[model samples]
Target: MKLSNSTVLVTGGSSGLGGATVRALVEAGAKVVIADVNIAAGEALAAELGDAARFVPTDVTDEAAARTAVDAAVTLGGRIDGLINCAGIVVASKAVGRQGPHDLASFTRCIQINLIGSFNMIRLAAAAMQAQDANDAGERGVIINTASVAAYDGQIGQAAYAASKAGVVGMTLPLAREFAKTGIRVLTIAPGLFETPMMDDLPEAAREALGQMTPFPARLGKPQEFAALACHALGNTMLNGETIRLDGAIRLPPK
Candidate 1:
């Protein structure tokens, strides 16, 4: 869909990748809804963007909250034309560690937020978009989900994170097919070693070393790059049901 005047909902839009997407969409003339749990960041971003955006406090895993966010998106621009699932958490723990088996709670939490949370937003947004009239191309909306390269080249400590992201990649095609009848395309973007908050806690040297892992360019992926791809995916109706890896040709070692 054309970004101009289209309404899109972005989860985890308060910061990081989602924040970049929200900014880019606004710049492209799209009305955006920032759905995130971070109230301060969300409100501040919406304020900064003026009338082009709205901030809705949302926990993607909670159905009620997600629905509220959807409603807010519709209210912001009169209809929902796209949905970007960017809310996720990373968990690094071996299945069997020196202490013992990895913490089950942490694994479950990762899955709940990354996988289930994405689905929650998709379901609700699809329903809303379905109610709207389709364009000449019979396109009502587009949905983009965020996965991780860990799903494919998971390191030794990435069992939980990998599984959760893998689930995202696994669902793309099926969701695309199912939503085809409604003219709502589904796709996923699997990012690798991006400069996100997840890497913020690492030492500067550690972060630099991680950036060096990418084969080409030899640097961390930028949030703006991810946003550019997201906008491109939304506008290109032919791109659907595929998990496009935004990685810079780097495959993780066993570690």
Candidate 2:
């Protein structure tokens, strides 16, 4: 789908990877709706982008909130052309450590937000997209999900995080196939270490060390880079049902 004049909904859009995507989509001439729990950041971004963007408070895991976000996008742009799932959390806990078994609640929370939340947005956005007329390419909309390299090369402390991301990767093909008849495409982007808000908790040296681990470019991935890939995926209809790795050939080691 051509981004120019299209309408896209982005979750977790208040900051980090989702924030970059919102800016990029608006720059591409697409109307954007920022769906996030961060009211302050979301509203600020929407204001910064002017009429091209709107902020709708959303909890991706909640059905009503997700639907509201979709409705807001449709209202703002007249039709929803795309949905990007960028809302997620990271939980680093060893299954067996000094604390005994990892907190089950943390594991469940990670799954709820990272996995189930993504699906909530997908289902609602897709339903709205199906109601719209297809473009010349018989495409009504496209959906991009955010997975992680951890899903493939999970570290020792990433059981919850890895499992959640893995679920996202697992859903891509089946969702794409199911949506084929309706002209909506589903895809996932499994990114490696990147400079997102989630990385802020690390010390500067630690973050730098992690970046140097990448085989090439030898630095942390940028949010804009991820956004660029998302834009590309939206434009490339043949790229459906696939999980593309945005990592710089980095196979994470167990830590």
Candidate 3:
């Protein structure tokens, strides 16, 4: 769908890649809803972006909350043209840690937020988008999901993280097929190492070393790069039922 004058709901939009996507969509003339767990940051971003953006506190795992966030976008433009599922959390723990088995709660939480939460938004947004009339190209809306290269190249201590992301990757084709009748496309992006807030917590030396591992440009990806891909994915109609890798030729090593 065209970004100009479109309404898009972006979860986890308070910061990181989601934040960058909100900015990108606004710049491209799209009305954006920042749905996130962080109310303060979400509101701040919405206020900073002026009228083109609005903030709706959302927990993607919660069915009611996810629907409300979608409704917020519909309220802005009477329809949701796009939905970006970026709300997620990550934790690292080995299956057999020194403490014994991995924390089952942590693992479950990761799946809850990253996998099921993503599915939650998909169902609600698809339902909303389906109700709208199709565009000239017979397209109702597009759904963009975020995965990680870790889903494929997961190292040690990434069982929970990897499984959650892998679930996202696994859903792309099936969801796309199911949404085919409604002309709602489903696509996933698997990103590599990046310069998100999570990365900033690492020491400078450590961060540089991590970036150096990339095959070319030898650095962490900028959020804008991700934003660009997301915007492109939104506009491109032929990119359904696939997961695109945004890594710069980096295959992470087992640590």
lDDT tens digits by residue: candidate 3, 100-158: 99999999999999999999999999999999999999999999999999999999999
Model 3 reaches what TM-score against the true structure? 0.99
**lDDT, model 2, position 36:** 96
Compared with the true structure, what per-residue lDDT tens digits does model 1 show for residues 1-255?
Answer: 899999999999989999999999999999999999999999999999999999999999999999999999999889999999999998889899899999999999999999999999999999999999998889999999999999999989999999999999999999999999999999999998898888899999998899999998799999999999999999999999999999999898987
Candidate 2 lDDT by residue in tens digits, 1-255: 999999999999999999999999999999999999999999999999999999999999999999999999999989999999999999999999997999999999999999999999999999999999999999999999999999999999999999999999999999999999999999999999999998998999999999999999899999999999999999998999999999999999988
Please identify model 2 stretches exceeding 4 Å from their true place: none
Distance from true location, Cα of 230 in model 1, Å: 0.2
Worst 10 residues of 3 by lDDT: 193-202
Model 1 steric clash total:
0
Cα-based lDDT at residue 177, candidate 2: 95
Measured by lDDT, the strongest candidate is 2
Model 2 residue 175 CA deviation (Å) reads: 0.2
Instruction: Give the Cα error of residue 167 in candidate 3, in Å.
Output: 0.1
